[model samples]
Target: MTPPNPQDALRAAAAHVSRRRFFTVTGAAAALAFSVGLPQAHADEPADPGTVRQEPFTLGVASGDPAPDGVVLWTRLAPAAFEPDGGMPPAPFLVDWEVAHDEGFHRVVRRGRELAHPEFHHTVHVEVDGLAPGRPYYYRFRLGPWISPVGRTSTAPPQHARNSAMRFGVVACQNYPGGYYTAFKHLANEDLDAVFHLGDWIYEGAVSATGGSRAYPAGTLPAVFNHETVTLEDYRLRYALYRSDADLRAAQAAHPWILTWDDHEVENNYAGAISQDNLPPDEFLVRRAAAYRAYWENQPLRRPQRPRGADLRLYRRLHYGTLAQFDVLDGRQYRSDQAFGGAWARPGGDADDPARAMLGERQEHWLADGWRDSRARWNIVPQQVVLAERRSEPTEAYTVSMDAWDGYTAARTRFLDAAEAAGVENLVVLTGDVHVHYAMDVKRDYADPGAPAVASEIVATSISSGGNGAERPASYDRLTKANPHLRFYDGRRGYVTVALDREQCRADFRVVPYITTEGAPVATAASYAIEAGRPGLHRV
Candidate 1:
């Protein structure tokens, strides 16, 4: 096989973003929507100093994958109605960028400018190097006459570098058309070292009524909300609508983020060859391309993930000193088709179908290899969707959500078994996409409900997309109770906060009262802890 281009997956993914019309953010709160690309310097903005704004960028700012000597900086120039379908008329201008040691820009370190116009969303990414490791720094942009707000970012200590511990916020499934992003706002204020956006950042379709029980309608609700999304315009619209939220942008600006995607980013239960919606691979590729493109342009991913076509490989590893090695997996692109039935799918438990596959053949091997080499005391697998064994009752209840690991049991079992063989220590699985919260004891045999627990799973509730305070009903409760391995479950709208010490990793399931309205209060729905070396999780 040809060596996979480390950047191929992301670039292929970004091609989906419509580059026809580029929006420019010129004023405060101008409607926001845009995309990303490599450094393209403009002539309008003269090279200037730090912490100053000559031009205003409305989409805010963010950073990601910080290394001791380098970091990825991101910001988009958005104009009202920024869409590739001739939404925002193109305007040629220079976009400038700078990074400083202080908020005042008094100690200038790295600075460069990029040229941007319509047709690529005018988003510029600067991968700065020659910076100290494990340190925090502030940066901003200079657009024509206004400067974007100053944003803060940090660098990752070398894998072997030793020092104090670090903190990061875990978030996922913040679907648009559901509610506000108060959880992101809460995290934005906290002094977090990083944010792990596991997946489902945006539902890849129209507004959802699936949120029904918890949904607050903009006008009226769709009976099904087929909610088709394909064009570059649709994806751009979704990202613009999502980033328009102040809290989301603030959280992005607050810390460098590490990311991975779950199914909803494209559609529900999208396997490699098929989508839950039953679209062909070629047709779905059109949509997947758009989704990935918009995702890259909107976030702080490095230069590698820029739009290439309709595919963006999202699997990668992040090492934070000797403390941890985060093996972020891409569960969608190469996953197998969802298991046919639902809760009633089957009970004989033939997960060893030998035919069904999850994580695909390559990702499974990659994960196993990664685990074999994991040097951290903690091996955190931050990903999108369910990895835990779900023991739903013997009913015909099936979710079209084939995107989850529950939909591909054989592949999952193989991957888990491989991890077991790899001698991977402190295997902690962090996930989003189920919309509900669950802490499960990964087991070797689900057929034997009493199987010994293997790894630990902490499934975070959605950031907002679980609708407003939705529950999985009491019947599902029976499923958890029947599964001895599952320690906790809650179907609410919220986020998860993880705090790590020298010995254990504690996960706090932070739930918000409501996302339909602003200024909501947050309470811990639940929490779980895993001791180092011991992969099994226990309720705290």
Candidate 2:
């Protein structure tokens, strides 16, 4: 059916409401849409729910932040996803949603309506509650005659229940122009209960019209995407482009995701409110606010994660009964500026300053408190950046990545100390953002060669970043030799699958050999098991 013109719909709706009320509502939404210098939409009437003609669910559906009672269902009305306003009029549309026990809506448990507001890019975040725990549910969205693709999600077990096993996937660093999302296609087929996206979800760099490494034909992407993203509309359009990937949409539809951001979501190697290029704090904050706002609108995040200016409270906890407790952290938002100028560098006195924090003081305290109260068998910390120290030269020179936990020596010590104080026996750190897979033993003291292992770290490779990587990069041998705690390392494009039981946590390093072309087969390049009470990696 031909869709009703947005202008016509607005004119029809204007006849129903007082002119003052119509302008009051539509003006507010338009103001928000153009807040970051995006072109203003024409002043119009309130949206009529029945007038929506185009299919609004072009970006597909997703579920996230699954609780014991329910999960958050998400979708956006993006009939013209590439457009700055997502092709919707500057108004609100009432969206209908349903949660069902089966794929078909015959066994629906809950159904409701929510307004997709233009102020939030017409995205819907349905925090559905009052459902049975530890069971799967199907969800979909509706707007007039349009229906979203069905998404499958499940809740955690009862808070204190003795859940035996929990399996999940860890992924990160999906640079849209770098390669195809071949790994995500394979990941979507995995038997995972949930997915932990450890940030760098979208790169903020410019995309060539040819689409970088994948090399799409000329004119495939718009000229607007050829420049760096700084404004709210820019970030939103970038997400729209990335979400257009079928593999990514498939993964989101297949399982719920828990996510946090790394530097590239705003600027590469940025720290806190500081921009990498040293832009003034106020100027950088404006950009950060835009990035954060677009991030929330695109992802399957709840209202609690919505951005308030440049600030967003992303660090939080999730429990899977007695099996595991996931402390998803935000390493980029509140961190101190990278010591000795970011990226690979030698340590300096500032790197060891106790006052400097990776998670900031407040979030550090929150994480420690959560650990003290956690009753789960395995305490999993899903966060951005590598937690273990990797020496560059495999010698005593002490060259390391200032962007990672290695740069914040005292902060790393504080984290381990707090975990130890809280009696966290089975600690597993899930990390991303180096574009490589690494299995390392978290040492009590990196300075001491004989230090005991305090925890285990499983770092997942990128979904498709750094192109198709090698099994062993040039410095692989040196890195392993330098850090004795480093058990395994691989440079490939894929994700990591983790399974936790009462006895042990197993990590399978899944890899796809090629991403420049589509349909690459995925395989487990390596596997390691971290036994409970023994915080170290054991090849299996």
Candidate 3:
């Protein structure tokens, strides 16, 4: 057989970094290698940097990845976000952060000073601890006398504590240039315990005027923001552009976010270290590392999730008392290169390769173990792509997008089988990417003519990725008819609001009528529920 292509070979090699090898790597050596690629430091903060001329907290503040004792606070000092250096001199600045029980900071619980280093775009990530569990807190950052907007976040309940109900707002795929973030504005208004961002938080490509409801002004398109992101600066600039949106900022401040990335955060349809343009492994790995680093710096994630070399540890578990257990997974990093060279491929042949994986070996094992050991009432997997099989055409001979779960039939089967064998009764798979909303019953064996539905998959619509979309496209109607397991489908821009309890899980498909303009009203396109015992969706 012809030697595997460079990308495939590279993936195989990377997958060999087993748990043993990962633990054996010296922390000092890893840190030393990681420090080499950091951008040059700017001047250290002087006693006073003269009259503070820049508004550093323009991107606003956010908190995410909440645990019972602590949550991660984030704010980047970007006065001019679109600029290469965010218009900051190379320097380390002392930024102060406070967590208070009240919005007025009258009862300050935790306060600290952190350095906003130039290397990470002067972003400060504070992992605050020693707070009450299952409670809300107000937080803000300060630079000199300037204070950021006070944001709200809550800690998860103690791991084994019993809680009656929990609510979450699921959002994803907000392409900056597509339209305004009216969806986020509405999402901020909802009363939610936390938010789960499934991925594509920022698209890495330049904006075009032809496809969106409203287009960015020509004057606002800086040279740095108009091209595909390849370097660290480019990715940082892309995130800055997205973070500048008022609605996006509001959504971030409204609740703590659980974040994981899909392809657009780096490039469209990229698999592992493979680029869409098919660049060499070494060259593409450099770009991958840059993307990973920038992703870490921009989000409200803890230090443990920071990128080490080209690897970022994102797949982990979070518990919300005894109500639910969240297995936030990373699907892009360790996945095998898409079959047919990352293009549309037939469902047989290489697509059936048992070695082909979406979560690689370690993460797949981790998820299975989590399923077996979970004690919460609900086991929710917030992941990147759809877990159920979806075909571009109805026929078995047709092609499917190899970038999704359909590309790895054996792996998907193995995972579903393991989940079923684990007796996971209340398993729910939440997904984003594909820019549409879908509610499907995840079959234990899709290939079996009489396969049983073992789980429910609710796929959220993009925040604004596909511009203003239709409520019911003709193709969507046909798709639902062809796949009986698919209960609901909509091509629109919005998100899914879910409430879980001991009895059942309720999902509301919230959609915005338009996105090209601002202040568009949101409506519930449909509501679905999965009872405690039954796995399929019951329309409400």
Better-scoring candidate (lDDT), 1 or 3: 3
Instruction: Judging by lDDT against the true structure, name the best candidate.
Output: 2
* Residues 388-471 of candidate 2: C-alpha lDDT, one tens digit per residue: 888997766758898999888889989999999999999999999999999999987777878888999999999988999999
Ten-residue stretch with the least lDDT total in model 2: 11-20
User: What lDDT, from 0 to 1, does candidate 3 have?
Assistant: 0.84
Give the true-structure RMSD of model 3.
3.9
- Estimate the TM-score of every prediction: 0.82, 0.92, 0.92
Quantify all predictions' global Cα lDDT against the true fold.
0.69, 0.87, 0.84
* Per-residue lDDT of model 3, residues 113-159, tens digit only: 98887777789999999989999999999988788999999999999
All candidates in order of lDDT, best leading: 2, 3, 1
Better of 1 and 2 by TM-score: 2
Candidate 2: lDDT of 360?
85
Please identify model 1 stretches exceeding 4 Å from their true place.
1-56, 81-92, 208-227, 341-344, 347-351, 394-403, 447-451, 470-476
